[model samples]
Target: MTEVGKTPWHLWVVGGLSLLWNAFPAVDFTLTNLQNDFWLSQYNEEQRAFFLGTAAWANACWALGGFGSFIGSLLLLLRSRHAVPAFLASAIGLAGVSYYQLVQNGETLKRLFGQAPLYTTPVIWAVLLALIFYARAMQARGVLR
Candidate 1:
């Protein structure tokens, strides 16, 4: 059995991997919002246009999803119980962003970006849910305090 108040080995491994996994989205969110020309230039015109024309609310959702998850990973590493709420917030944000992409502008995006989003969005949701559950489990075990 794991000792109370002692950090488990799996926590470090999961937290580290989660941090690395989330970093890309966090960076992408930052660069896209900043409208960094060099970063924006990497995408084709349609892709750039899709990202550039995103609505303000959608951008806010994206920020919460990306940055919230990143913060959650950090909090997890710190053994904070607050990581649960952070991941929950990320889920809310991800839902909003997914709605915007898959429902509000689904046809347009599908035409512009193909079927990749449809496949990938569910995978992202699954990963986020898994993180949330893991954090909760850690908290329940008193690993996160």
Candidate 2:
């Protein structure tokens, strides 16, 4: 058992890895929102148009999912208890975006991009949930004061 107030090595590992993992979404969100031509050139015109036409609320949720998770990872590294709520907010944001993509227009996306979304969305959720649970566990153990 870890001593109260003592930081565990795994916390650093998880925090660092999660931060790095979340960074990709952060960069994608920024570049996509900014309409970086070079960055967005990867997508076909139709796929780009479809993404660019996302609703304002969905955009907000996307921001939350990307930025909030990044913040949560940072907070975890800092050993802050606020990481829990940050991660929760990130999850909510992810749900909103996922609903918009998978339920609201799943067919459109599937038609455009095939099965990548179907495979990726669950992996994203799994990682986020694992981080959330890990943060909660750390908090309960007094490692995240």
Candidate 3:
């Protein structure tokens, strides 16, 4: 519906990348739910907790980002700025935690991702990111608050 050649850059880059993230599991699920001693009788108390905590952080980030995208994108698409961009920026900062989760190649997710692993909800992420940016743009344009 947007006029041809009128598509926004972030619309494609961020939004499209989000979709790419959703195409796969995004990050390893086991990493978040599992502890180093998940299956072992004698698990490293510190390490186990560390890994588990690490995973939790990752999920938290993803959710944070998702929430931002949800509210921001919705407002943006609606051409409003009822919510301040500062809140959205903070949310995005928290979402950065999700990026921490990921098992790369043969490396365990408990450590750090060897490389950014494929995300589980690329399409969803893309749609969400689009909303955040859209709302931000609307605010910049003086369309809303």
- lDDT winner: 2
The residue pairs found clashing in candidate 2 are none
Question: After superposing candidate 1, which stretches have Cα over 4 Å from the reference?
Answer: none
Candidates' TM-scores? 0.95, 0.98, 0.39
lDDT of 2 by residue, 31-74 (tens): 99999999999999999998899999999999999999999999
Better of 2 and 3 by TM-score: 2
Clashing pairs in 1: none
Global lDDT scores for all candidate models = 0.94, 0.96, 0.46
List residue ranges in candidate 3 displaced over 4 A. 1-54, 82-87, 90-95, 102-106, 109-134
Across 17-69, the per-residue lDDT of candidate 3 in tens digits comes to 44444323223333335432335334456545544555455566655554444
lDDT of 1 by residue, 1-145 (tens): 4587688898999999999999988999999878899989988888888998999999999999999999999999999999999999999999999999999999988998899999999999999999999999999999999
Error of 3 at 32 (Å): 11
For residue 117, model 3's alpha carbon misses the true position, in angstroms, by 2.6
- Per-candidate clashes come to 0, 0, 19
Order by lDDT, highest first? 2, 1, 3
Evaluated at residue 143, the lDDT of candidate 2 is: 93
In model 2, which range of ten residues has the least summed lDDT? 1-10
